[model samples]
Target: MNNRKYIMLDGKVIDKSITETEFVKADKNYLYDSFGKRYLDLRSGLWNTSLGYSDEIYFSVSKEFSRLMNKKLAYLDIHSFDCKLYDELSTNIISFVRNNMKKCIFTNSGSENTELALKIASAIYGKKLNVLAINNSYHGSFFGGMSVSGIDIDVNGRMGKAYEKVKFIDFPDDIISEESMLTWLEINLEQYDLFFIEPVLASAGVRIVSDNFVNEVLRLCKEKNTLTVFDEVATGFYRTGKPLFADRLKYKPDIICLSKGINNGISPFGSVCVSEGVLVRLEGKPIYHYSTQNGNLLSVSSANSVIKYYLKNGSLLEEKVGKIETQVKKVMKLYPNIVYRCVGAMLAIEVEKQDIMRLNTILKDLGILTYFYNQPTNGLTILPQFNINLDVLEKALRIILNKIS
Candidate 1:
């Protein structure tokens, strides 16, 4: 037997001898393994597949792009020249965000977008750079992302001393009053070149920060003339029942890092949507960054379809999520031991740390897959597809509640 495992799971190489179940097919919201057993993927492809597997919009878009590629009509390299798909994608993304996003820079993934945003920030600041981020927040895996990330920055001392300028402050908490938060920012925001934040800290057990706190952060950044970047990679594209979680904010972010649902997980694609101010500052900056797959035509086409799908069905989907939230709250009242939070289609139910693994395994055996974590909070996170069937979700919830009860 070959001892070499060619794949890494969760940043560690897995033992090759340990066979894993393979998902051979997918339905609306369920994945089918080779044994023909089906499991509901409540995490929605790591919260990227908002429309779910086998969605008609996704299928149609994919088919169209495949045909175009076969005809050799849509091959485009971002480094070369812009194409019609690029123009349309930019227009739709700008309108979808419906904020101060004046320009869009395409990238390969969320990590790449984070790195590019930091590069742009570095260009604006030129040499001396200080970044302030909230504790328990995750940006991505890139060096710049890891630096700004409040969590996992010092994992095994891997980040090194290259990002000493990046600092972290406590996320807004009950113990830390609003006054204290403002005072700290008022005195220190000026020294920082950029402030990175996630409206909802997905990796931190789906913790949603208060709107007032986010707005205050923006106000202080504005007052101090510091750039604010909203890391919306996980919370963007109608995740919080809004176009972007930033939509709920009082002030617009200078730069918005977007990915995940941008293309409905159809491709490795992401984008940095910049405000007019940030765009102006980026002009003439010798920030040389390029990727052959940055503006792939197929990704652009899929993104266009995703934007259209949201525009057409966003209201109905949001209504469904609202009903689901209400239903879950009612059930949660019965279980005092469980602490849970729901924002739109996203949900987090915290349980005892000791029970984390047991519950996750039980759920998996019962044919329900969710995102689970034991850090910051021990809980199971459920992010159902926006177009998920309510009755199906109700059944799944019942099973989960019964098992926990």
Candidate 2:
């Protein structure tokens, strides 16, 4: 009946043509219906928007870029403020990753970064074309990302069959066990060009693998010359309490995928941190994967500012999550059946198995929104923004658990 509703339906039809995922009502940290019912942005823009809702730096930078373009915007190809901003952002990015990660390449979304990382791996090691991704991890919605995404509950039947070149290994969980994972890695990683994974499984309900296990995998990847890319789209920019939760684990990746928080949710730009091994050959011949909007000056400038903010408040970000982690585990212990998965800033509440969908719907009515995740582990993800007020967060969690019971 409403034009906005009609447009939303049409847009979904269009987007669904490309991918099976759809969106709910969202503008900033809040999503509203056509009727204008506001919902607390519990999921934080599908795990982006670390700063959440009307980020001042994004607005400020966007206004400046908009005003500059109003005067005389040069060809993005020609280079101007846009190019300078990207250079600065790259420098800021590389400084951290370079010391540990090695190199960086820009992309338009996490999926692009994932695909590009795979491409880089293929370009570097043609003999080992297979890329490994952890079972139950979510990277992106694109075909490449979907192919590597082992998140679907019935992916094999739904996606027809995974691409032969990409292998999905059962990522470690309480049930899977570390010894089983290491044996699996030892057997499969030798012939892989790239092995993609999340340091802490996010969509599959934030199950964290131990740092010791992660470092061992990295060692194996290095020995096999497999490019290991840690998909850090959710974990980056303080969501996981550190730039790379790998740092928390003391394991370094050859490539680390980043997005979501890159521009603080003002704009979208994704990047893959490349290691020295991959960058050394870039000068030999040009690698030609480019997006029209890749590293646009406006987004890059916003990203640089966002990183600056993260640097200043990084400790606080971790501290908040750290406190929440300790508190939730304590609270959850009081109600273990209701809260199932726990790792870092993300956690999942499991009510009666039959009541999962009802629990999700009821929580949305209670103002906290979460998604049905059937990957790596079948559970919902509670990825609140890094800056979500502690009181509001605890209240939300209480609401969520109470609604379920």
RMSD of each: 2.2, 4.2
Candidate 1 segments exceeding 4 Å error? 1-5, 15-19, 353-355
The backbone clash count of each candidate, in order, is: 0, 2
Per-residue lDDT of model 1, residues 1-405, tens digit only: 256546555566555422255789888999899999999999898888877886687677878788778888665777888677788888888888877898898888998887898888889878867888888888888777778788876552663734568788877655367569888888878888898888888887888667888888888888899999998888887778778888788888999999999888888889899999987887888797898888778777888888877778778767776776776677678777777887877888877644777787788888998877666778889988866777788789778877765
Q: Which stretches of candidate 2 lie over 4 Å from their true place?
A: 1-37, 70-75, 78-82, 96-99, 152-163, 281-286
Per-model C-alpha lDDT, please? 0.81, 0.69
The model with the greatest lDDT is 1
For residues 1-405, write the lDDT of model 2, one tens digit per residue: 323333233213432221222345455467676667777777777777667775465566667677657867522641223466556778888764443766677777887887787667666654436777778788776666777877743554565633556777877765358878888778877777778778777777777777778888888887777778888888877676566676776457777888888777667787888777668755464345767677466666567777766666667777887776776677666665665776667777654454566667777766677765654335567877665676777777777766665
lDDT at residue 113 of model 1 (Cα atoms): 83
Q: What is the lDDT of residue 33 in candidate 1?
A: 92
The 10 consecutive residues of candidate 2 with the worst lDDT sum are 11-20
Would you list the clashing residue pairs of candidate 2?
Answer: 103-274, 136-376
